[model samples]
Target chain A: MSRFSFNQITAKPWTLPEMVAGCVAAGVDQVALWREPVAEYGLDRAAALVRDAGLRVTTLCRSGFFQLPGWFDDNRRAIDEAAALRAPVLVLVSGGLPEGSRDLAGAREHVADAIGRLVPDAAAAGVTLAVEPLHPMYAADRCVISTWDQALAIAERHPAEHVGVTVDTYHLWWDDTVLEKIARAGDRIAIYQLADWITPLPAGVLTGRGLPGDGCIDMRAFHDAVDKAGYRGPIEVEVMNADLWERPGRDVLAATMTSFERSFRGR
Target chain B: MSRFSFNQITAKPWTLPEMVAGCVAAGVDQVALWREPVAEYGLDRAAALVRDAGLRVTTLCRSGFFQLPGWFDDNRRAIDEAAALRAPVLVLVSGGLPEGSRDLAGAREHVADAIGRLVPDAAAAGVTLAVEPLHPMYAADRCVISTWDQALAIAERHPAEHVGVTVDTYHLWWDDTVLEKIARAGDRIAIYQLADWITPLPAGVLTGRGLPGDGCIDMRAFHDAVDKAGYRGPIEVEVMNADLWERPGRDVLAATMTSFERSFRGR
Candidate 1:
């Protein structure tokens, strides 16, 4: 229970203030924030609100579409926002191949280079750039970094504090070898997140994630691996489902917490 | 284009006779047939129709749902069907985990054991059992064999003449290490298939494939790898697109042939 954190995206419609208050009321000590709502509610005010309520910001949701124009400036601003919000990590979902492009190898090379370029800014702002490997299904339209090995390959080139990898069960549970590799990742594991893989993926294949225990993933394996890595950080339940989004934020948080408890029970 | 084979699933709505006639009309010499429609049209009759037309059956579409009850008998029947059609290879899509179970490793072991149990029948019938590794997205509900390594690992334990792996571009393009491994696979490469990966996958994700030139797969890379592996066999175009299925069988075959020609044009 001490490690549980509710990622704001789990309740997609919840504003920063409302998410903070809901987490506080639910007795969750930490919350992970997304950039859009934080900017919508004003970064400083949102930071102050969470701080005043005695909640720790686990991570900033994301900021890495490196394939797009203005990626450098946008990512630099994201680093600044992360620093201002007192979040230790900024998740990076490397964008897919450029439009009309079939060069996945080239896109991946560009991601490695782009992350190399962002390291100084992140280090200066004191925020870890967590490279997240989205599922291979998303390799075409979302993120080309689609495996634990790929994420670690890029992050190993930088200092551990400046660049790291994210461990999200939803994006990685299909992999047979990821658990053992993740167990040895140590400090390179920037943030740990949980989302179960459910069937009948939606059209876009983005928001069909299940709560921790609602699907077939063996969450205890992930928990054991992260523990073996000596990670003592927030375990954020970051599911994104249309049905979950329609519910009230408090209800979603409560459900997420219950799911987390269920997943971690008897451990 | 002597090596080109048009898989029947590319024209989903075409009947067994209509598909055979259409393939003959398109000047196609070889085809890969699925078990469902072949059974519907009477396997023996369907075999005679294609055999009389002098069309060689490249491979049988499938036969490996090891998780189901009666999988052994069903697979034996599939092997008989392949023998009747004179198809050299029987593609195996190892079924997903059982109901309410999350033991992926156990499921994979069951598939290997099930295949081992069927190897004698396959060898006696002169049908090569080609284990197919589906895209990892289908790992939960369709096939547990989700990577080149996993497929190859199981196949290596059996005689190369009796068991091998199916390399489909759509299922494997995202893998960085597969090309080199496939290049070294030698005679263990049983069937080579092509289908491009397109964006915005449809619901269920079973019928969202693209024609060779319609999406992002590099057909030439696959060609080169298989060539280096000393494979000189039929290259079946096995795309399952909803829009393509809506078209007439003749039109679909023409378009698939054109895509195949374009993909292999300069190579």
Candidate 2:
């Protein structure tokens, strides 16, 4: 439970203050936050609230849609926000192909180059730019980086402190070879997020993630891999399920803690 | 056009006789067939219908649910049907995790062993068992095999004439390493298929594929890779789209042909 961090997406409706209070009541020491809610609640205020509540911000959820018009400015702002919040990492979900484009290879190249451009700013902010490879199902509209190899390739191009791969089990568990490669990743692993892969994925494939033990993923394999990679960081339970979001934040946090114990400790 | 084969799923509602006749009228020389409708239309009659129409059967749709009971016998029956239709290839989609099993590695091993057990029968029927790596979205419930490397690894275990890999652009387009690997695959390429990856995938995700030029896959890249691999087999369009299914069979065939020409011939 000490390593467990409750990602804010697990309870979608919970505001920053409510979430902080709920996590405090549930005895969660850390959280992974999304950019939208943080921006909505005012980044500095949200940061102060979490800090005052004695909760560590594990990561800031994303700012890397390179295909968009103002990606450069947006990512820079995200880096600033992460620094202000004292979050060590900012997750980057490289956006999918530009509209009407069939150039996936080109899109990937642009991601690497875009991340390279952000490396200096991220380094200056003392935040790791965690390149997250979303599931291949999202390759068209969400993220072109759909494998650990792709994320690692881009990350290896820069200093490990500035850029590293985000290992999310939901996006990567289908890969048979990823576990072994992840074990060898060493300091290149930025943040490890857990969300089990469940079937009958809803339209858009976004909010269909399962709680750790509710799905078929062998969480032991991921835990062992991350451990072998020498990553000593908070493991965030970042499930995004419609059903889970309907529950109270405290209940969701409790269930998340239980899932973490069952998946990580195999209780 | 001599190399173009219309896979029956592109026109789901078309009967075997109608599909064969439609192919003939459209100057199509080959087709890839599914097992269900063929069985419904009477295997012998379906075979005769295609044979009489001078339409060569490029490959039989599939038969490799190794996780299920009687997979061996079912695959053998499929092999016999392929033999009856004079189809040179039998595409295999290795079934997902058994009922509640979380051992993906174990499931993959079972697939390899199951295929090994069926290789002799497939070889005797002069049919190449083409292992298809489905998109990873289907890895949990539909197919365990989810990458070019996984499919190739299994295929390399048997004689190239007996077992080979199916290269479908829809399943493998997101893989950056696959194009170069496919170029070096040589005769291990049994069947080459095309279906573009479209956005906003519907529930279940089984029928969300786009026609060749309708989505973001670089079709020419795939064509070049297969050609570089020295493959001379027929190319099949195997899209499964809900929107496409609502149209008349002839219109679907025409639209599919147009997509193929635009994607392969490039205007």
Tens digits of per-residue lDDT for model 1, A1-267: 999989999999887778888888888889999999999999999989999999999999899988899899999999999999999999999998898888888999999999999999999999999999999999998899999999999999999999999999999998999999999999999999999999989888888999998998999999999999989988999999999999999999999999999998878
- Candidate 1 to truth, TM: 0.99
Model 1, global lDDT: 0.93
Local distance difference test values of all predictions, in order:
0.93, 0.93
User: Whole-model lDDT for model 2 versus the true structure?
Assistant: 0.93
At residue B80, candidate 2 shows an lDDT of 99
For model 2, the stretches where C-alpha displacement exceeds 4 angstroms are none
lDDT string for model 2 (B117-198, tens) is 9999999999999999999999989899999999999999999999999999999998889999999999999999999998
| Candidate 1 runs further than 4 Å off | none
Model 2 lDDT, residue A258, Cα: 92
Evaluate candidate 2 and give its CAPRI docking class based on DockQ.
high
